[model samples]
Target: MNKPTSIRMCAASLLAGLSLLLSGCFITPGKFTSELVLSQDESFTFTYEGEIFFLGLSSLAQMGAANEEFTPQECYDEDTFEDRECTEEEIAEQRAAWDAGAETRAAEAKKKAEEMSVMMGGIDPSDPEASEELRRILLRHHGWDRVEDKGNGVFDVSYSISGKLTHDFMFPVIEDVPMTNPFVQMIIRDDKVVRINAPGFSAQEGDNPMGGMAGLAGLAALGEGASGGNGADEMPDLPKIEGTFSIVTQGSMKIRANNTDEGPNPTPTGEILTWDISPRTQNAPTALIAFGQ
Candidate 1:
């Protein structure tokens, strides 16, 4: 073989090895991209009873929701045993128990936020000079007015969301996913989004895994408005659930919307990018974007 060709081959091999080393030494592409999920919503507070896989780490922190709806409905299903209807006093006791549980979860979520505040080294998510780009995105698209520094990466996101679900029966959908929150406080370090977690969501509607009237009934037991989530239960006011997500800077983009209005849900359809390269005519570099499967 020609000497030049042999030298070129060796260079390619060396570059490949370097890429592998850098990924392991710092963070893998998968790990880095998953972070995009953090920026998408802003909070990651949910029950951590299961394993969490994001941020290149097996787990970061965890979240807990109020168990105020454990009404023991299934306990009396098979009435071969002498089971009697719960007395009014018993019902009151059960409701109080659930309320207490919800309060406990709320406190735990606040503590986690505080810990994350400590964890993100006190980077203010609302600082205009801090995560300026993110702030702009919120303002332009979602009307999230601003962020307030709570002494950490955590910031109180203020926004107004007004929409109605058209349905004959009052149902609930995911106001926030079980794992991510809308009023998400974000911490940016080295120009990346981090510390995605938030409060225990007070309510949701329609499409929850724990579905049907059971879930709605559970929420309604909270009181006059916690069930269907009143107007005050809009976007900014309610506590939110965190989701498992990732971000890839300028990686790939996917756009899908909820299709519950239709008879059935349709698959997410969009331009799918399977390679990593950009054209140079416009003088732009790629950015990391989030993706979900």
Candidate 2:
């Protein structure tokens, strides 16, 4: 099964360039809430629950139509210094073709968005026996275990993924995977250097094991209407994405500590920390938690 172009882009580009530009994209508004627990025995667990609104999908479809209909004045006469303007009939034909193409693309986008919306909205963090598919997603994507729905868009989960770190502050450089891949991770230095455990992802890996609708490169132009997004001036007003992430952690740990950079800070209460996470447009949201020896 070939992976979608959007997934490939996410796996390859989200961390480096796209991660920084997510807010300007067309990710629907929603909330992500998570709880992480690291035991004294050097083990960790993470639970996440949240929703991603798909109301903006229609706008995205419209953007696709716009892109399809766009045609640039060309230097059709290569040897001449004059640019060739498209005739009205030519323009009409182009518009018709674009509309025809956009209809198919728009329909596909709409279907995908609706499916994703249902799946995301089905997460009941409070349910002890939530969808097994959702549980599988958490485990495979984030290496979490004992996944439990916390109800009301909260989750009771923990991360079982653990690895040793090289230094107290050295961020483990995992090649290919984006830092904001919506997956949970942990690292521990076995040489008595230090141990670090962290769990994240209030939303289970978007809409798939590879990547979600966010990975669709075909939808790239759809984000043009987003606030501060490309072509925003001529584009229609895009709906504002609304949501936040409430995170809590137990055991001994620090979030975004050391020399590593971090996203917006969340409220901290002893071991619990909460962040205001908005809908991501370019890349998935991520938080880094650290433990000091």
Candidate 3:
């Protein structure tokens, strides 16, 4: 589906406007589900020492992992990479595991999102000194603009501001406070946003400077961890999150989708394509925390 040139050109201009669409909604059956469409396909990019991570809001990793064992290998073929129909036992077990995982992740994510929202509310993003200072430290030398918002849980954010970036060195003690995970970044287009960017974190082979000592050093560290050592503490854990969610079928509003094949029939259709982030989270535990090691 070829989008009009105007829609493509006006994408950036549309980001800030769609952030609040979720804030204002009505709950009417067959009318309003009171759900918000993620305005962006992904969330903000948090770069630490050149490693880019995504922010996730859904405890999808936990839930998916919890339900993974229940899925028969036949349900997930490696060759064609197709998912076959599941048996009753698989469905029941997977549902139970997923349900349990959802409760844990949702509770954690909701609490964090609310806390960040409150903190942001207290701070004046408009204050020149405050905003500029925050933009420098938080966004890392990036300028920012507060995009207007609708009542939904979404809001516009602009980091590409004009002019130089300068700020004071005064640091607040509260600034050191740890924030929750799954920070979402929305992408907008054509006065409407339909995607979200979730943040994540990962740990790879730690920096080993010594040539022959490199592999040996890494092995020793692994030994320490195996011997109940805190070797892994030097790096952060992988954060899990829902990549981006959308309503396949529009309820009350008009459905404007691109790349959708109005074909005759296919076995499976719904492909919740998740972004393959840099660091992959563990696939075992259905419930886990990334912070505090």
Candidate 4:
């Protein structure tokens, strides 16, 4: 196979392997602005504006699986293990092999989709009505002011909620959606300390599952269709990781720990911690604060 073909094959295999490890449910942050405010009196408010993606139901995962079927067989030199052109007979043989296994692969794919549907509360990602169903589900929640289905499992949404910090709080507590990972979380400890973490805002692998998928998809796109050819512009648009996350605290609240580059900056309201998120952001935003006795 040629270089472009080789790259596509490798990328497809990598995506297939990753899909196995990931759950059927994944919610990740896209371009957006998010903020959290903690007061000295234990009151809090949070707001998020931008895109939220459902990876499993998106074309990203589907494309990864679909590409595998088109991967051409590659032949190598026996002794040197270097790439070599295949004989016509060898090409024909490989083609025959692929055709023979088509049925088996199709059956396997169907079975996997069924399993994923069960995992996602019987909502089938492949179903034509799935996107509208998800939109309706999100609109039923309190903070979702607007939920626009952008197709391919991405939604442009606005969410804002406020309440006293008497219990732990998590953004995107959607009904019927499996709790795999949260975009933001605030945990109130017994000693009145509040720990904040925003994992979905980062591009790190462990921090956001979509980040890893986006990286792989980018690599896969580098093959023929993406380089310079008739299909160059036909490549699917990949998800972008860009956002701003801020945490504001009352001046009286004690800051115990944080991971911002410049730490907390003094503000008239109190102190502010900000993270400018991008594809290169390796660590998620985090902070720890406490109220006075």
List the global CA lDDT of all models. Answer: 0.27, 0.38, 0.27, 0.74
Pull out the clashing pairs in model 4: none
What clash count goes with each model?
32, 18, 27, 0
- The residue ranges of model 4 lying beyond 4 angstroms of the native Cα positions read 4-8, 17-24, 67-96, 206-234
User: Which candidate do you rate higher for lDDT, 1 or 4?
Assistant: 4
What digit string (tens of lDDT, one per residue) describes model 1 on residues 1-293?
43333444443443333222222211111100112221122222211111111111111111111122354321232556534566677777877877778877778656644543332234232234543433343346443444443321233444333321111111111121122212122333232323222111112222441221122223222322322324234211211223222222122223322111122112242232121111111111112222322
- Compared to the true structure, candidate 3 yields what TM-score? 0.21
Per residue, candidate 3 scores C-alpha lDDT tens digits across 36-139 of 22112221122112111111111211221122232222355569765566688877787787777877777765564454334443333223343334333444
Model 1 segments more than 4 A misplaced: 1-75, 78-87, 119-293
Model 3 worst lDDT run, 10 consecutive residues:
26-35
Ranked by lDDT, the better of candidates 2 and 4 is 4
Stretches off by above 4 angstroms in model 3 are 1-74, 77-83, 118-293
**Model 1 C-alpha lDDT versus the unseen true structure:** 0.27
Q: Write the per-residue lDDT of candidate 2 for residues 22-116, one digit (tens) a residue.
A: 32222332344444454444444444444422212333333332322354323245586544666777778767776678777778656644444
Candidate topping lDDT: 4
Model 4: weakest 10-residue lDDT segment is 223-232
